[model samples]
Target: MRRFIDSEADFIFVLAANVASIQAEQDAIGFDAPDAKYPHKNAEGLCSFAVLVQEKFSDNPILMKMARIVQAADFKDQLDDHPAARGLQLISGGFPIVTSNDHETAERAGFLYDALYASIKDNVGL
Candidate 1:
């Protein structure tokens, strides 16, 4: 957060458990909640970051697949909605996020996400 004090990102992502206050303050959305402008689900019944991104650019195949994957992974109880979700969770579980190294864990996971995105983009089928 302190890093953003000097430099602000074009899109502020608040993927937290409790996003009520943040939504009110920043007019942002969350992993599962919606604000005044954004809805929790889209017309296609997509939720999470999926709906948000889709609203802007729905023509891309890669983004749509990523959104589907994200929608499944966002729900803790329905992690099995997508086979990759459990694998991703397990892989991330191996990280040092528990030791308060969230930034480090996220940094390590960045490449993994990039790889996944690339895989999705390269493949024609979901």
Candidate 2:
């Protein structure tokens, strides 16, 4: 997945979104509707992923920042800490854009993930 993202391969973003969404759901255990898709159920695992990314990509400062974003987006409720949390919640829940087809949903959201990655990549200097 990392390679795909780096190489600008096709379908990488949507694939990532789908994979992340599914893993978050399966790894998730207990939570009420609307909140279930978020990482509230297993925050330890989510944070652990960030740690793993940090350890693996210690040289890539941008990836490390992404790790922090993932952690905060999944765990932090204070929007100031993780402004993307609300958007992640909505997208994961398939709110306004989700359709009956998972593939289609991923395909549509692929662009969004691509934009997000681009934003992260562009802000690497910051």
Candidate 3:
């Protein structure tokens, strides 16, 4: 999990929650990635997309909430202690996150995504 600085919001909480969800899946089943890949390799594009979505749904409280959650959960410390990370460690038997696909375990990835978006929106006052 990547960490973001420059804010003290609840982004860590949201990230932890999402990570937890994903780790659950990995524990139940398994992950298959031949080579290491950057999950958010296109972060710039993703950020741009997030901005567009926020702009389009500026009046939607639900969207706002999601952004705020994400923003608040973006801290580095949170990523280090995230439940998902722990879960992955247990399931993978000590594999590094870069080689793991534990984040796919979330049953409700959509909900988690929504919450993250809301958290980010709230933090940026968008």
Candidate 4:
């Protein structure tokens, strides 16, 4: 994934597993969704990382719909939040099995996401 980024990129952002270990950098941003102890503003407490990003760039209805599905699928307690969460479960649960690596899996999943967005746009008139 880092290889896919532009060489001239100004900054990088990542969802850190441990935000405390991240060194201060003017060109990078790190976020964490800790489930346990925290100073404040944890992602798991309010919403999934997907929701946080979607809310920021929510001008597109299709992406917003996908984000809702992601939020439901990601949270154990909110698995029923969206009707399509179960299907997302099946797709994501087995996605890594056939793919060769993290980058490959994510790149292949892009097609599925494209189809989903198109389907939503066509069927839901979004």
- Best-matching candidate per lDDT: 1
Runs in model 2 with CA error above 4 Å? 2-52, 76-80, 95-97
lDDT string for model 3 (7-56, tens) is: 33222122432544554544421112111121221243222223433656
Clashing pairs in 2: none
Among all windows of 10 consecutive residues in model 3, the one with the lowest summed lDDT is 29-38
List the RMSD of every prediction in angstroms.
5.8, 8.0, 14.1, 5.5
- The per-prediction tally of clashing pairs is 0, 0, 27, 0
Clash number for model 1? 0
Is candidate 2 or 3 superior in TM-score? Answer: 2
What's the candidate order when arranged by decreasing lDDT? 1, 4, 2, 3
TM-score of 2: 0.47
- Expressed as tens digits, the lDDT of each residue in 5-52 for candidate 2 is 245433322243354554465563222122333323344555543655
Residue 15, candidate 3: alpha-carbon lDDT: 45
lDDT string for model 1 (31-97, tens) is 4454434456555566645765566658878777777776777566768888777776677667774
- Candidates in order have lDDT scores of 0.62, 0.53, 0.37, 0.60
Quote the lDDT for 97 in model 4. Answer: 96
Which stretches of model 4 miss by more than 4 angstroms?
1-41, 44-49
